[model samples]
Target: MGYKQRISLLMLIDSLIVLVSVVFSYWLLSPTLYLAPAVVGISSVTLFIGHHIFAHVFKLYKRVWQYASINELLSITTAVSLSIMTLAFVQLLSFQTVYSRTLLVTWMLHILLIGASRFSWRLYRDTKMQSDKNKKRTLIIGAGNGGTLVARQLLNSGTSELYPVAFVDDDVTKRDLTIMGIQVIGNTKDIEKVVVEKNIEHIIIAIPSLIKCELNDIFSKCAVTKVKTQIMPSVEDIMSGRVSVNAIRDVQVEDLLGRAPVKLDNKKIADYLTGKTILVTGAGGSIGSEVCRQVAKFHPKAIILLGHGENSIYSIDMELSTITDGIVIKPEIADVQDKQRIQTLIEKYEPDVVYHAAAHKHVPLMEKNPHEAVKNNVIGTKNVAEAADEAGVTAFVMVSTDKAVNPTSVMGATKRIAEMLVQHMDMISETKFVAVRFGNVLGSRGSVIPLFKKQIEAGGPITVTHPDMTRYFMTIPEASRLVIQAGAIAKGGETFVLDMGEPVKIVDLAKNLIRLSGLTEEDIPIQFTGMRPGEKLFEELLSENEVHSEQIYPMIYRGKTPPVNVNVLYDLIEKSHHLDKGELKDLVLDIAHFKTKYLTQLSLVE
Candidate 1:
C-alpha cells in the first residue's frame, strides 16, 4: 500500500482499539448498573477522538515499525499517555460518574498492545537480516562498549555481510555472559578455538584502547587461525566521535610500533611559522612533504617547495593547493648541490625560515659512492645554510640522523659533517642555524618495513641483515613536527635530539609483519644474512663527549658539539671537490672522526 493509505489504515485500527479499551473499563468498574447505550457511545467517541488526535500530532502512524528504534518506542508511550489524560478529563465533564480505576486499567492495556505490535516487526527484520546465506560468521575481540556497538550495527544493518557469532573478552565476570545475543566464549588465548568451533571466517578487533604488546599477542593468535582480521581506529579517534565502531580497517605496521602519538605545541609552531615565507629543501621526500602539511596549518604567507625530483615536488604542491586558502605555494625544481641556484632562489624569495632536508641517506649506496654523498649531504647542506645566512633568514633548521653519532658508515660521516657545518655557521651568521637529529622513520620511501612487506607478499624468505640488529623508529609526522618545533627554539649551533622511545629489534619486527599479514614464521621464513657493509648493530643518537640539556619543549633536547673552524671546513670542502673516490673517502673519514677499524675496513674494500 501507499504511504498515506497505510497511515490511514493504522489510524482506523488504533480507533477500534481505543473504543474496545474504554468499554471494557466501564463494564469492569460498574457491573451492577445497566450501562446506558448513549453513555457508552459518548465515552467511546471521546476516547477515540482524543487518541487519534494525539497520535496524528506525534506522527506515530508515519513510522515503519519494521525499522523502529527507541525514538519510535518513546513516540508510542507519549501518544498513549496523552490520549488517556484527555479521555479522563472529558469523561468527568460529560458523564455524571468518573471511572478512575477503569481508566488506569485501560491505559496500561493500550500501551502493552501498541508496543507489542511495533516491536514484533522489529524482531522479524533482525532475524531475517541475520539469516542471509552469504553472511560471514564473525568473532569480536572486545565485549565492552566498543564490541556492543559493532554487534548492534551489524545485526541491524540489513545489507551487512557479517554476522557476529561470539565475543572474546578478558574480563572474568563476563566469561559466560551474552551480549546482543552473542556469547562471550573466551579471552584472546581461545581465539583459535573459538574460530574453529564457530567456523568464523572473519575477526574484528573492537578494542581501540589496546596496548601494542596486547594487540601484537592477539594478532598472533588470529594469524594461527588463518582468519581475516581487522581493527578499529584508535581510542582517541573513537571517543572524539570522528569515526564509528563499524568503520573497521586493515591493521598497519604503524599500529604495531607501540609508540603513542606525539603531541605538538601548536602555540610554539604557530609563533615561528605565522606570516612567514618558508622554504623546504626536500619538499618531496617523506619528511619534507609532512613538514609542508604541518606548516600549512599555521597559515604561512607563502611556501617554496624546492627539490630536484619533479614528481615528488608536483605531488606535494597539488596536495597543498587543494587545502590551502591564502598560502602561496611555489614549486621550484632545483638541485640543492648547485650553490648558485640555491643562493639565487634564496635571494629572490627571502624566506623567513629555511628547512634544509635534502641529503643522500642510504648507507650501502653512499659507501659505494662516497663522492656523491659528500657532494649531496655535505656540500648541499653548506650551500643551503650559507644561502640562508646571506639572505638574513629568521631561522634555519637542518635535518640530521642518529647515525651521525660516532659514525661508522659513509652516510653517517657525511651527515655529521653537515651538522658541524650548521654549528659553525651559527657562530658568525646572523641567521639562527640549528639541526634536529633523530633515528629511522617508519615508512619512508626506502625504509625496511615496506621492504619486509614486499618480501612477505612474494611468499618467500624475508631478508634481515642480522638477527640482533635494532634501530630507533618514529612516524614521519612525529619527525616532521619535531623539526618544526626545533626551529621555534633555535638560538644557534645546537643539535636537537628527539626522544625516540625504544629501539625495535629487526627480527621481531619481521615476525610481527608476517603475523599481521595473516601468516606465521613457519609459513614465511626469515633468513639472517651477516651484516652488510656500512651497517651497524645499533645506532647512536649522540657522540661520546656531546653534552645535552633539557629544552622547553617536552620531546626535544639540545646537544653541544665540539666547535669546528669554518675556514678549515671551507678549505676541506674546496680540496675534496678535486679528490678522486679513494682520496675523498679518506678526507671524509678523517674530517668526521671515524674509528680506525671502520676506516681500515673501507680502505681494504677497494
Candidate 2:
C-alpha cells in the first residue's frame, strides 16, 4: 500500500482495538444490566484521543510490522499503558461512577489486542518468506555473540539463499543451547560429521576472536567436509564499527595467521607524524605501502613515496589520495641506490622523518645475485641515510630483517651492512638514525604464504624447504606500526628489534594454508624439497654479540649494533659497482664482518 494509506490503515486498526477494549472492560465491570452508555462513550473517546496523541508522539504508525522486534513490542505496550493510565486518572476525578477495576481490564486488553495486530503481519511474512527446499543448508561455527548475531540477521534478512541449520561451538556449556532457533550441534571436531548428517552446503566461521591455531583446527575439519567456508570480519573491524557480523567474507590466508590484531598507541604515533613531511623509500612494496597508509592516518603534511616501481608507487598514491584529505602525496619514481636521485628528492622535500625500506629481500634470489643485494640493500641504505643526515631529518628509521642477525643468506648480510651504515652515521649526524629489525612479514610480495596458497589453488604438491624449518612472522601492519613506534623512541645508533612472538614451523604454516583453502594435506600434498641455497633452519632476532635493552614501548627493544668501520665501509661501497659478482659478495661480507660466520653455513645446492 502507499505511505499515507498504510498509516491510515494502522490508525484505524488501533482505534478499533481501543474501542473493543473499552466495551469489553465495561461489560466485565457491570454485568447486572445497569450499563451506562454515556459512561462507555466518554471512556472510549478519552482513550482514543489519549492513545492516538501518544502514538503519534512515539511515531508508532511509521514502523513496518512485518519486521517487528522487541523494541517495537515495547513501544506498543508503553503507548497503550500511558493512554489507559490517563483515562484512569480522568475517571477517578470526573467519572467516579465507573469502577476502577474497569480501567485496569481495559489496559491489559488494549495491550494484547494492539500488540497481536502489529505482530500478526510479521508472523505471516516470516512464514511466507522462509522455505526449507532448494535452499543451501548453512552452519555457523560459533555459538557466542557473533554467531548469534549472524543467525539473527540471516533469519530476518529474507533475501539470502543460505539458511542457517545449526551451530558448532566448542564451549561445553553452549553445546545444547539454541540461538535464534538454530541449535548448537557440537564442537568443531564434529564439524565434518555434522555437515554430512545435516547436508550442509555452506559454513560461516563467526568467531571474530578465534586465534590462528584454533582457526586452523576448525578449517581443517571444514576442509575434510568440502563445504564452502566463510568468515566474519576481524574483531578490530567489528569493534571499530567498520563492519558487522553479517559482513561474511571469504577466508583469507592472512586470517590463518591467527595473531591478535596489533593495538598501537594512536595518540603517540599521531603526535610524531602530525604535520610532518615524511619520506618512505620503497613505499610501493608491501611493508612500505602499509607504512604509508598507517602514517596517513596521523594527518601528515606530505608523504613522499619514493620507489623504483612506478606502477606500485602510483597505486599507493592513488589509494591514499582517496582516503586522506589535505595531505600532499608525492610519488617519486627513483631508485634508492641512486645517491644523486635520493639526494635531490631529500633536498627538494626536506622531510622531517625518513623510513628507508627499499631492499632486495628474497633469500634465494639474493644468494644467487649478491651484487644486486649489496647494491640495493647496502648501497641504497647508505644513500638514504646520508641524504637524511644531510637534510638534518629529525628521525631516520631503516627497515631491517631478523636474518641480519647471525646472518646466513646474502640478503641478511647486505641488510646487516645497511644497519651498520645507519648506526655509523648516527654517531656523527644530528639525525637520530636507527634500524628496526623484525622477522618475516606474512603477506609480503615474496612471502611463502602466498606461494602456498597458489600451490593449494593449483591442486598439487605444496613445496617447503625443510619440514623442521621455522621462521618468525608478523602482519605487515604490525611490523609497520612497530617501525613507526621505533622511530618515536629512537635515540641514535640503536638497532630496534620488534618482539615477534614464537617462531612458526614452515610445515605447520603450509598445512594451515592448505586447511584455510578448504583442502587438507592429503588433498594437496606437502613436498619437502630440502633447504635452498643460503636458507637457514631457523631465523634469530638478535645476534649473540648484539646486547639488547627493553624500551618503554611494548614489543620493541634496542640492540647494540657493532661499530661500523666508516672508512672501510665507504671504500667498499665505492668499489662495489666495479667488482665482479664473487668479489662483490666478498666485499659485502667484509663490510659487515660476516664472511667468517656464514662461510661454513652456505649450502649452495638446492
Candidate 3:
C-alpha cells in the first residue's frame, strides 16, 4: 500500500474504534445512552488525539504489521493505555468529574481493537504459510538459539521450501515444549522415530558448536534416514552479511569428516604477518592461493604471487586484488626452479616472509617423471629457500606433504628432500625456516574428492585405488590457515604437523560422496583398481619421533628434524642427472626413505 493510503486507513480505523469504544463505555456506565453526550464527545476527541500522538511516537505507522511480535504488541498497549488515561484527565478538566468505570471499559476496548487490528495481519500470514502443502516438512535438530532462529525465519518466509514441523533437541528440558508454534518432539536418539512419525522430508542441523565426533554421529544418524539433510548457515556468516540465517547449504564431505579446525592465535600471526611484505610461491596452486588469501586477512603490506603458470598467477592476482584494496598484490610468473629468477624476484620484492608451496605432489605422475619431481619439488624448494636466505627473509614456511614422512612414492621422497633443504637452510641462515606437513587437502587439483565427483557425474564405476587405502584429509582453508599459523610459531628446523583426525578409508569416502549426490551404491558401483605404483595403502603424518596429531597441543605439533647428510644429499643431487628412472628412484629412496644411516651403511658395504 502507498504510504499516505496506509496512514489514512489506520487513522480512519482508529477514529471509528475510538468513537465506538467511548459511546459504548458511556452507555454501559450511565443510566441512559444520552446521559453524557458532551462527556462522550470530549472523551472520543481526547482518545483519538492521544492515540495518534503515541502511535506517531512509537512509529506504529512505520511498522511492518505482518511480521509483528511482542514489540508491536507493546507499542499498541502503550498507545491504547495512554489514550485512555488522557481521556480520564480531560474528563476531570471539562466536566469537573471523571467516570472511572467508563474510562476503564473504554481502555479495555481500545487495546483489544487496535492490537487485534495489527496482529491479525501477522496471524493471517502465519496461518496461510503453515498450511502450504508445497513446502517440505522439515525437522530441526537443536532447540537452542540456533534452532529457534532457523524456525522463526522459515516461518516468516512465504516461499521457503521447508516448513518446520518439529524440533529434536538433546536437551531434556526442551522436549515437549513449543517454540514459534513448533514442538520439540524428542531427543537425538529418537531422530529416526521422529522422522517416521512426523513424515519429515528434510532436516536441518542447527548446532554448529557440536564437537566433530558428535557432528559425525548426528550426520550418520541423519544419513541413515535417507532424507535430505543440510547445515544451517553459520551465525558468523549471517552477522557478517555473507549469507542470511535461512541460507542453508547441502552437506559436504568436509562436514562428514567432522574434524575441528585449529584455532589460530591472531595476535601472534599478526605480529609476523600484518603490514609485512609476504611472498607465496606456487601462488596459482590450491594451498598457495589459500595461503595468499589467509595472509591477506592479516592486512599484509603486499603479497607477491610467484608461480610458473600465467593463467593461475593471473587468476589468483585478480582474486586477491579484488579482495585486498590497500595491500599491494604483485603477480610474478616465474618458476621456482629458476634460481636466478627466484633470486631476482625476492630481491625486487624484498619480502619479509616467503611461503614455498611449489612442489610436484601427484604420486603417480611424479613416479613416472622422477627428474621433473626433483627439478620442481627439490630444486624449486632449494632455489626459493636460498633466495629467501640470501635476501634476509624473516621467515620461510615450506608447505610439505604428509607423504614426506617415511616416504614411499617418488613425490613423497622429493617432498622429504624439500623439507630437508629448508631445515638445512635454517641452521646457517639468520632467517627461521620451517616446513608444514599435512595430508590430502580436499578439493585440491588432484585430490580424490574431485575425482570421485567427476566419476559420479559421468554416471558409474567410481574408481578406488584400493578398498583398504586410507589417508588423512583436511579442508584447504584449514591447511592454509595452519600453514600461516605455523609460520607465526616457527622456531627454525621444526616440522609442524596438523592434528588431522583419524584417517578415512578410501572406499568409505567414495560411498559418502555417492550418498551426498543423492545416489545409492546401486547407482554408482565401486571399482577396485589395483594400487597405483609408488602409492601407499595409507599415509603417515609424522615420523616415529614426532607426536601424533591427537597428542599435539593446539593442533600444531613441531618435531626437531635431524640434520641431513650433506654429502649424501649432494651426491643424490649431483648424480641424479645421469641416472635412469629406476636408478634415480632407488637413489632418491635411499636418501629420503632411509636417510643417512642406510646410505652410510651402503657406503661401508661398497
- Stretches of candidate 3 off by over 4 Å are 31-33, 235-245, 546-553, 595-598, 601-606
Clashes of 1: 0
Query: In what order do the candidates fall by TM-score, top score first?
Result: 3, 1, 2
Residues 430-467 of candidate 3 have per-residue lDDT tens digits of 99999999989999999989899999999979999888
Q: Which candidate has the highest TM-score of all? A: 3
lDDT of each model, Cα atoms only?
A: 0.85, 0.84, 0.86
Decoy 3 TM-score against native? 0.95
Candidate topping lDDT: 3
Q: What does candidate 1's lDDT look like per residue over 1-606, in tens digits?
A: 998899878887787787777777768775643277766777678778888888888888888787777888888889899888887787788775566787797888787777876788898987886777799999999999888888888877778888999999999999989886799999988999999999999999988898776777788788788898989887866775778756888887777776666677888889989999999999999999999998999999999999999999999999999989999999999999999999999999999999988889999899899989999999999999999999999999999999998787889989998988898889888999999998999899779989999999999699998988999988898899889988987888888888777889999889878878888888899999899887889998877677575555676778878776656666777778688877787777777883444334322311
Rank by lDDT, highest first: 3, 1, 2
What's the number of clashes in each of the models?
0, 1, 0
